[model samples]
Target: MTWRFALVIQPAGVDDDRRDFSATFRTIDPAEPALSVGELSTQRGDGIFESIGVVDGHPQEVAAHLDRLAHSAEICDLPAPNLEQWRQAVARAAEHGERRGEGVIKLILSRGVEHGPAPTAWVTASAAADFTVPRTQGIRVVTLDRGYASDVPDRAPWLLLGAKTLSYAVNMAAIREAKARGADDAIFVTSDGYVLEAPTASLILKFGDRFTTPAPTGGILRGTTQQSLFDHLREEGYETAEELIPVDLLARADAAWLVSSVRLAAPVTAIDDTRIELDSGLTQAFNRYLLTPRD
Candidate 1:
């Protein structure tokens, strides 16, 4: 049977501008069976989405995120959201969520919502989830040898792996595999041993006196936090490079860190059981730069 669902709106208040925006859903009946965000498998999965952290009621790098979302929707052939309408809707949900002071906001757009066995465009918002910085102990991660499914052809041929899309099953599965090995996350690596990125975030590391991250060309998302750090550090005379990174070599580096919107900056003390120097001049500078409040 076809299912219905409700769009849950989280209002913005407390510190936001108090503007309101509404998102959507099908209003599925609670009596019916349910699948999870990571469990849908029957339909052609074609959609786009992004998650941004709300800091003191503001979404960090808000303009860049909106631009990326719109670009991703275009690449996936999803209907363009009326930017004006979308802005207002997100504003409303944030206001209703009352998580404006400190929280995370997820903006999702699906072209797989069906009315009667056929999918249609639908946009929705989840209630604001809690946001907190992760610990400094750092996360352990595994490297994935293959991307997506081993056999199925890539649907979004234009899929910019860097764009935040809702098609995250592969990423989730990679994390599971990493965890089975006692790691906290997963990293995607090319067959030749070049580092692509971690499952959900961008990877960055220090090699001697320089800081580097995988190029977006290698399927790594150009992260806002990474971008912020690059710019902030460059002003301080740190050289940043965007190029192919050999996985084996990063293990021999002075230090490494994976960056994200909410997790902020997490340093890596070990990789595949190999220990790394966790404290250094570069990492200390990064810590000082990252601790500043978001611009």
Candidate 2:
């Protein structure tokens, strides 16, 4: 699928009103080299990013995404982003892709090269047809070991365990291994045998009218999409809580889902080749609520 992307570099200390699109923002050719050869984000994966879903012509949950991005950047020790500048860039990119239907806007912040004092920032909007089938048909996921104990983040601050940084080689590898094993995705279980999260999404387990997910304090990145879903569920008379989930709870859940910004929510029909309960009715409700604009 063809993608429409916007790449903008706003130098630090620049006023938003004085910025020039012609000079600062470029419509990137996907086939061309987008980053400098010396870029640390490429060389060392030292960056933070956020993927926001764009429906129709508007970016969904932009403020929440930005807040998460800021937190990630802060955790990565990068300079604070100019929210207005990033917002403008995201809008330009999302509009460029909206004509083709829904898409995703990715905001990337990188630690500049060792020789440079400024950071690098860019946004891209890409076609998102990949989620169509999985969202409707549900997905099969396998449980994988994350190799870190549940309480490791509390003891190791420098590990940056909870930050949504660009260093996702392990997460990518986990998903690849799951796909090789005939599953669509993978959920990460802590070394201590607790449910943590998924490679690219958050895990939510449903039992009747109650929903439970891992608390962010357990070193998981705070899930903006999952938070929105929990809020909606609460309003709909469902109970929700953030707690440490045991790996075996998958067998008890009436339904389970992997949720994120672009894909929204995909019900887990099977885990590790074991068939689990599927709640198409609840899954449909989640999709409707997620795709609907909040404001």
Candidate 3:
């Protein structure tokens, strides 16, 4: 998590002109203490964020990430971020880096100090970790009960399920628990035995020639990487779908992957104590497509 560059953003209103908002971005020392002790983002995790993958000097899927950021803001009741301002901010931060092999750009908007004037926003760029082992050799996973039904999102909007909020204590704990249980990652399953998603990635299961991910309806954050892969797969003439996947379906999957912005696509070699075969050719193809620069 070593940041190469950071920028503090004086976020503009949704109606602000791009030319006027460009000056609001200011580069800052990544190691400097820039946050107040009373910031709600640090105190109560009251914020939303998006992470965009960078290849060479290009920021991938900028429009999709910004769209998700706005959606998260709406769900969390934060101010509507001016997309143009954030777009320029992301570009500025990305350009501040070395523009080498792989990197990541993160856009964060917090609720600011507890009773302060306005929200706090910033962007950070960092070199992405080498995921060659996970991408090539694959990873082991375990399923954990998320303590809610698949319909919890519809039944409890206040939970802020689908939004990519900063409140990730539970998600981190889940990953730690998985590691303690002798696995590399964890997949969240509904109390009623339905597949959801990973703590930090989206789940995609393949059955024969068809690929399916859990429907975004079940408190699952819609994955930008998964969507892009789906589009690519469709272009390649492969069948893809989003559906309510049952937990038992994992045992029958021909192949599976956990995809994210930073790590790209990682094959799942085993689930729980059951060994699942890895699709090497497809995995390589997925990573090849993912590593390429895409807007």
Which candidate gets the maximum lDDT versus the true structure? 3
How do all models score by TM-score?
0.73, 0.93, 0.98
Residues 160-248, candidate 2: write the lDDT tens digits. Answer: 88888889999999999999999999999989999889999999998888999998883798898899999999998889999988888
Instruction: Kindly report which residue pairs in candidate 3 clash with one another.
Output: 61-295
Say which candidate scores most in TM-score. 3
**True lDDT of residue 270, candidate 3:** 95
Model 1, range 206-259, lDDT digits (tens) per residue? Answer: 887798898776255668778888888789888999887777877777877877
State the lDDT at 39 in candidate 1. 26
- Where model 2 places Cα greater than 4 Å from the true spot, the runs are 1-3, 11-24
TM-score of 1: 0.73
lDDT per residue as tens, model 3, 1-295: 3448999999899988757566798888888998889989999999999999998878899999999999999999999999999999988877777656889999999999898999999999998999999999999999999999987799898999999999999999999999999899999999999999999999999998999999998399999999999999999999999999999999899999999999999999999988889999999999999989887
Give the residue spans of candidate 1 off by over 4 A: 1-42, 97-101, 115-133, 147-160, 280-295
Error of 3 at 145 (Å): 0.6
Order the numbered candidates by lDDT, best leading. Answer: 3, 2, 1
Which candidate model has the greater TM-score, 2 or 3?
3
| Positional deviation of residue 123's Cα in model 1 after best superposition, in angstroms | 7.2
lDDT of the candidates, in the order given = 0.60, 0.84, 0.92
